[model samples]
Target: MAHKFPRISFFQRWSILFKCIFHYGMIFWYG
Candidate 1:
């Protein structure tokens, strides 16, 4: 599943990292 994406741009990579952080933060705060 993790290998399907093309890491061709810095913004895409940054956004993915940001999303992972945001999701973890939300779960930590709400769970």
Candidate 2:
């Protein structure tokens, strides 16, 4: 259980970064 926690947190951080980058890319492309 302890080992699983860091993996989940890492995925969450990666997903957040991906989303933020994608969001800004879209705005920069279309805005």
- Which structure among the candidates has the greatest TM-score? 2
Candidate 1 residue spans exceeding 4 A from truth: 1-8
How do the residues 1-31 of candidate 2 rate in per-residue lDDT, one tens digit apiece? Answer: 7576998988989999999999999999999
**Candidate 2, which segments miss by more than 4 Å at Cα?**
1-4
Write model 1 residue lDDT over 1-31, tens digit each, in one string: 4556556566688999999999999999999
* Model 1, global lDDT: 0.85
Worst 10 residues of 2 by lDDT: 1-10
Per model, state how many residue pairs clash: 0, 0
- TM match of model 1 to true structure: 0.70
- The model with the greatest lDDT is 2
lDDT of each: 0.85, 0.94
